[model samples]
Target: MFKGFLTLRPSCEVCGLDYSFADPADGPAFFVICFACIPSVALAVWLEVAFEAPYWVHAFTTLPFMLLTCIPPLRPLKGWLVASQYFYKAEEGKLVRLETPRNDDLHPHSA
Candidate 1:
């Protein structure tokens, strides 16, 4: 339904809410990167231990598995994060009240 790095669509299907609030802004990629680190480190360690292979073998061994682990979940992770944003009404923070006093208020004796 959605497309592009930013949103391609302009509105919602079910709630009729505007799609602007759904801006996840790298959230999915961030999540994928955070997740990828764990397994990649583990894979590197495991390959070193299990195979007792040399450095060249480590490159060959880890490369394919890195691709296998990193590439597949990207789209789905992005979709889930976007969907979560939409359903939960996630958005930038708002200015509820500006409490700074006016010049007159600050210098009431002068006034």
Candidate 2:
């Protein structure tokens, strides 16, 4: 499911930190909302259903649950996003560097 959502792979633009897509062993990053976060989210939903909490309670409870789910996993997700913007090109037994446009440049129109 996440594979479809992530249109770009993670890599370091400056350091050429690209992962091998062909390798079957390279599972999705923990922070990318794979199997681990699902159970907690499901549990949160169950709590909401079982307790019949008011809307505000459900909304407040969800914030912490989402933080728990998201915070730890962010490291790898950020690394991957950074890496995806760069790649290594070999030339004459040396490596040449290339970079994608910076995030700021991509969103210049935004306030």
- Highest TM-score among the candidates is held by which one? 1
Off by over 4 Å in 2: 1-31, 77-111
Q: Tens digits of per-residue lDDT for model 2 on 1-111?
A: 123344334443566555443222233454346755676678678877899777787678776777677666655564454444323331224667888899898999885
Candidate 1 clashing pairs, residues 3+ apart or interchain: none
Error of 1 at 8 (Å): 4.8
- Number of the top lDDT candidate: 1
Cα deviation at 98, candidate 2, in Å, is 31
- Give candidates' CA RMSD values in order: 4.5, 16.1
- TM-scores, one per candidate: 0.62, 0.38
Number of colliding residue pairs in each model: 0, 7
